[model samples]
Target chain A: MKTKRIRAGAAAMTGVLLLGACGEGGPGGSGGDFTDGKLVLAVMNDQSGVYKDASGPNSVKAVKMAVADYKKKHGDKAVVDDIEVTSTDHQNKPDIANTKAQELYERGGADVILDVPTSSAALAVANQAKTHKKLFLDVSAATMELTGAQCNKYTFQWAYNTYMLANGTGTTVTGNGDKNWHIIYPDYQFGQDMTKSFTEAISKAGGTVQGTIPTPFPNDNFATFLTKAGSTNPDVIGTMQAGGDLINVVKQFNESGLKERGIDLAVGLMLITDIHSLGVDQFAGTMFTDAWYWNMDDESRAWADRFRDETGTRPTFEHAGNYSAALQYLEAVQEAGTDDADKVVAKLEGKKVNDVFLRNGEIRAKDHSVVHDAYLARVKKPSDVKEDWDYEEIVTTIPAAKAFPPAEASACSM
Target chain B: MNAVLQYAVQGLAAGSFYALAALGLAIIFGVLGVVNFAHGAFYMLGAVTAAVLLDTLDLTLWWSLLVVPVLMFAFGVVVERLLVQWLLRLDPLYNFLLTFGLTLVLVELVKQKYGVSGLPYKPPKLLSGRVDLAGVVLPRYQLFVFLFSVAICVLVWLVMTRTRVGMIVRASTEKPDLARALGINVGRWVTPVFGFGVALAGLAGVLAAPFRAITADMGNNFAIILFAVVVIGGLGSIVGAVVAGFMVGLVEAFGQAYAPTYAQILIFVLMALIILVRPAGLFGRKEATA
Candidate 1:
């Protein structure tokens, strides 16, 4: 009798469950998941190649921190459900980054992609995101073509580009009367773009490019390159290289004994992380353009400390940019109330943001290039370095409007 | 004229590294009949080991150079015994694939320990700064590298051609059947020969650390060039490897001077042209290769 009663009860419960299941094909099953009211971000970057340390897997950590901070600050307003971060190492290849970006959008369900370093890879990811109509926030790639020929509605380079760098460092050095330039550039698209940008900037500042040398990327030695630079007897030896290549180039440049001969060095782009690696003594009095510096102010230091605690290393500009881009993206999604591509993009466009990430940051509606002040920084002398991470001393701030190329000059139709 | 001199010096210096690496490749190919594709990885390992020694033990360059090669030599012996020896009787292509895979494993291992951005190795103070070569300026350390590497090469050559060890190695390599028949167990020398070959690669790595970007991937570009040097030198000929190393270097140096962009392509192009002219290479004996 007891068994029969239990069987009857189970049948009744099954009928109720079937009725509840049959009523479930309602508004929630729209298939427009939109990260399920989540801000899903995908980070694609060079994880195991030359650009690994400059911006790699640590970028993923930076994005996650942005998510955490967004939740803590805004509570349920940041994401309707939660923020999710997914990442992959692009290995400094464009095709790989593109495939990964596609996977992130189609399968991983990511709303934004951030922290791609190498120019080629970053450009590829930017284009891919545009085709998919998903947001791409480039953190560390330094190419001008992204904002020029390749600028899209969805792609926004969060960090520095070759043009801005060329403007800040190239113009300043040329303005100092160090004419007759000998430019040594890594023979790649980014390097080529930099060479063109620097030439234009130097001409504007009343300087002549005496000669240009194209060097192999990821060169083993720069002693020969430096010797050739010295051979030309130019007033300035401008190096259009960065990362490990930059480190080798700068080290050999300093040791080439050319400084005593009235030849100055002009680095197109530099980071505090680079200074820390190459030793501040080697770069003392060396002026360069930087997108951001960690110890820029009281607020930045507090944030950097938290970043250091998370990454176990001082936050590079790339790391800081990743955090900023991620946070801004979350805020844009929140403002839009949904992860719809058109709506979220509209919210981000023409938005003037003043957050821990951006000082007077304006996401220009025309081309989606974030315009912000870039710093003119000098490498602190050995005696001036107060701590291990203390490397750069801000000389002056180049306003966003001045630092970035105008729409007419950039010719970005989007 | 000054630029020519600079290119020549630079080319010759680069050639010296190629020759150092090719010497080991030639030895292993001669004794073991395998290409030892891991030679470049071994070279990189030598550099990584030296950098680690300096970072952890605060060891000086000279001492690390001494210690690194021996450690690498022993390491080569163990690898030969445990892994390489198992595939000795197989086809040469199999061994090539094995070593190629080994190179990736070794490179990845190093990358895991030290992040891929590369670590800096400071050159000794004695070798810092540029040396005024009367009218032209050359780096003091580079000049030292040219001289030091040549000396080590000579020492290696002397040991191969002059010493009792050389005699045994020659006999075992020249007539393995006769060597075994004459109460000389040729098997006993295989480990040492493999060890010696990889040791040379390790030594080249030590010599390179101060000059090149000491990273996990540093060996990759050079490894391709090293193979070309070996082929141009005539498969297993030590003297050929030495001669070709300098020749390729000179070609590269002069190429860089004239054609900076196409210099790397110029190397492989030269290799293809040389093969068309001499199938067994410039110094290779036709019958031996056949």
Candidate 2:
């Protein structure tokens, strides 16, 4: 799969110059717009790494579905005749992402990039988008910087961020009497952001921080950190590691008899796929914040059913977010009557959206964050699971206003 | 003090996999003189195979520990005969590149079959809980892994020291040209020795199947750390691999416990120090360095 993605990239690189020449000669080759005939939506993320399951090829599939559904809905009124989706594996490396993002914009002829997952890698691609003046809808990465200091006119943080996750889980968990907290986070931009956000949320909810431990990114083992966290005798241990790292921590915590020792785990961020991988029993009764859940309502269930038919697995929040972002981007293109980044950005800014994934979603004009209602969900017991992948039960809803940081707080001047 | 004991036990348990895999790397480097970059892939394959066996045939972890290594041994033998044996006479870099390529191919193939989400492997219920001894609490499986890997290391060490076959293999490993000149048929042991080394890696993989994430790229980082383990253990030293394995594990544990940020960096620091003090590794024979 990795080799295939590389081969595809190589092929695209070879065709770049020729494609660029042809694009300039097209009908709408004016200075104000750039749309040859088709719109290319490129999905770049950790295609073959730990985060793959959450938003890899499945995200690509969701993008394609968005195009198809758009075509079906608009029919003759569709702005673009065709929408093409392409994807590549950044392998969760920022340097690789920078190169691939450049390639996607220069030679790959991508109009918009979708679902760049890792916070650092996503930020790298955001820089490329800003440079190339292309749209980048970040559906998966959880860093607030994309909407803060690093925010760009060309990039949109679509699904969720560390602020939303920490606000939902940290406050609720601390408020439940687990006041003393020890945090273990992957030592990266996303992890650091999650730690800071969770600490803020915990303190706001009348709690004191015990300590915070930084573990290696993409690390397989967490025994040492778990031991260190336990040494402090905290009421709750908050883990900011996600995907495979989160699974390992939860598994190791279960094995270390920490739950029996009465030390509760507060997950900073979690995905349905992660819960499915470790089984519902391991994470049963655990509370975490979710951007979207497949079984939330009838409309969501219907979309998820179609998604299951396509991918043979239930969709994570990221998959739904990708679909929503892609569809919204296309709608914005239709509203603006062009694939030009500036026009699309104008159309999307401050737009209120209600879709299967984004409930009460608003594309804020200030920071480019698509703020939406986040759900505080608890993992159901194994017996409570009525069907496969039925993992979460929504406990409460954190409104859009409370879910994300206010627009004035953003460091982005634009 | 109890925390110290806990960290030490935890470190040793974590070291069990490294020790087992490094022993295989040492053996293969010792005899075949081929740096098996595919060793980690083989370790990944072992875990994948064990998970698959459990899923399809309902084989338990007990069965996997016994069955997976044997399968890996045969796989190693075939790999030697079909691929590695031909590159024996070339520059070791050629073989290293070959194994490196093999690692990619194997990893991609596994990823194709099992999506990157990783497979689930639950340890036996008996080994699922914790064991408390004198106020120190440790996972039951970690304790089992530490003890089991030590037993296998001792058994392999005994065979190398006592058995005629092992003696011949060791002679060839210690001095291949000299062994040939001394009327020992060193070439005949090449295939099995490689197979045995691979089996040790496979055995380690089986031990780790329940303890770690069983994914395709699981071995990518592992292989890197393993190289550090090998370098610190002395490239081709048998005892060094096992000793350095546990030693690195203990160091990693203590470092992680005390300095969580610099835990992984500490392994390389220790390796660099060992290399500076003794170019041929801690227990490596001086002649082997040449």
Candidate 3:
């Protein structure tokens, strides 16, 4: 009888401990009311499509890395030990992104969605985030609309945008005395925004906008457009094409003898993957702007080393941006002591961030634009590259204040 | 005047790709009574094969132009025997469905092996720079592609007209029922004819390797435009395919040059206008079913 009473007492103690573990949402123990006692990070982007090489699967891996680093840094103080990362392919379609974003928020129980690449798809997802009242950190998509006309309380425009790209490349190139410019861009939202931003920057820097050409997105041939751009004899031809289209334009430009005709080429935006696809020699001595380079500094190279070890290729700016965004999101969750969207939004807004991807970064409260220092780099000559994937040589740094448009100029009423 | 001449040359040069791929599509459709929707996939495979050959085997563009077609021909024969032959007697839609499925499989397989960023192929140093044709300078590579594709089309035309085997194949393609009634045995030539047609597509791909982006989806737009070419030329009409291929290329080039916003739309407009005029296509023989 005495032993049976002792056993019942032990069972009561064990039950109480289990109850405490389940109900712990205060201070230290699994802090905050987490859904299912865990955090779910959803990464949506183009996985098997044209933009795959730029971000795709690598972005997912970067998030996992961020989770690991966060756990390591926070150790036992980590808000939630069971952080889960899930991913789906949006295929760069806005409708698909809308459907998938709804499913992820409603059914999949994702707390936050990250790394949406295409601007149209990203906008669709931003709408879903607002409707669902879920946190979203956009890493790859570059349209300024996210922070301009389309800004919301739940969405944060994380990486570089069309405004930042144009502000850096346009001002730098025009300031270098290539006063007359002709721009060719894809006839889409992102391209239209880029053209507008570039024209503004060019005229501001005393450069004349000679012509503007709008071509189809994902077009393989640029010979016709290049010919038209060259006929007017602009001092520099600014190409606002990206991914496979950009490669075609560059290749055709060389083949068409445009460089020989004394017309300089200025890329509106470029990534390391592009340089890697078409060797450094194709873009030798060409000046362009980049948000982040893997080999930028020792801190970045250290992170990049870990990234390359996980993924076969070096991380692009999108990949690094994802890592930074994820880590920062988790940090905000921890700071707010909960994964609640409103609380996390308060935590992230106006927060200064310095990381491998974002140099002197600051998340603006009014517009939610993550302003950061952008690099103006020249594609190193083939002979200058000492190791693999060493493509860019940083020439100048566009400071964070000058990299993006002022918050007061934003069209976003939010 | 120089700009106009340049645009003309550019249009013709762009047309060469459509002309070559459409010619194969026309021949295959002519002989097999199959739409062969995978013609675009075959073109993609051709360019990919050339790029891979150069990347892996250290082969040059010259060798690729010579070798890729032969390889594609062999691949075409195997596909015809293993998958396509089984559906030959069924409704033509079945064959179309089968080839469409084949295109998906081949595209995914390629994407699995080589990621979507695309591969690089530099033209031979001999053909890399520009060629001055009087005052209208053209890229030597573009000029070479135009000339090379024309030579190939002529050779194909000769084979279709001059030889006894060519005559038999032509008879089977143009009037299969009549040829079969005459005891020509149209079944025997189907395999080689299909192989020959795929080879032409592969040839076009090889020529395009140095000129266009060598990606898995490179053939997607090319294929769509090729359908417009075949339709504009009249389905299964060899001369029509070639003529319309160059015609569409010129239209697209000029459209892109002058009406930048309506470049793609212009191709369809031209297709619509031609269809309105010639319901049977410029070179196609109107069939009872059609």
Q: State which candidate has the highest TM-score.
A: 3
Question: What are the runs in model 1 whose C-alpha is more than 4 Å off?
Answer: A1-35
- Model 2 per-residue lDDT at A264: 96
Per-residue alpha-carbon lDDT of model 3 for A120-227, expressed as tens digits? 999999998888788889999998889888888889999999988898889888999989999999999889989999999999999988999999766877899999
DockQ of 3: 0.68
TM-score to true structure, per model: 0.92, 0.94, 0.95
DockQ (CA atoms), all models: 0.50, 0.59, 0.68
- What is the Å distance of residue A107 in model 2 from its true position? 3.8
* Per-residue alpha-carbon lDDT of candidate 1 for residues B232-261, written as tens digits (9 for 90 to 100): 888888888888988888887776677776
Better of 2 and 3 by TM-score: 3
Q: Candidate 3's C-alpha lDDT?
A: 0.88
Report how closely model 2 matches the true complex, as a DockQ value: 0.59
Per-candidate clashes, comma-separated:
0, 0, 0
Evaluate residue A144 in candidate 3 and report its C-alpha lDDT on the 0 to 100 scale.
88
On residues A1-414, what C-alpha lDDT tens digit does candidate 1 reach at each position?
445435534543464456542111111212343533345788888787777777788888888888887788887555455566887888888888888887676545567788888788888888877877878888888777677788998888777778789999889888888978999888998889899999999999999998888888666566666777778899999998877778778767766678878899999867666666555777789999988888889988998899888878888888888889988888887787777777888998889987666778898888777888888888888899898689889998999888888856776777
Residue A126 in model 3: shift from native, Å? 0.8
lDDT of 3 at B207: 85
Flag the better candidate by DockQ, 1 or 3: 3
lDDT of 1: 0.80
Candidate 2 chain A weakest lDDT stretch, 10 residues: A21-30
Model 3 regions more than 4 Å off: A1-32
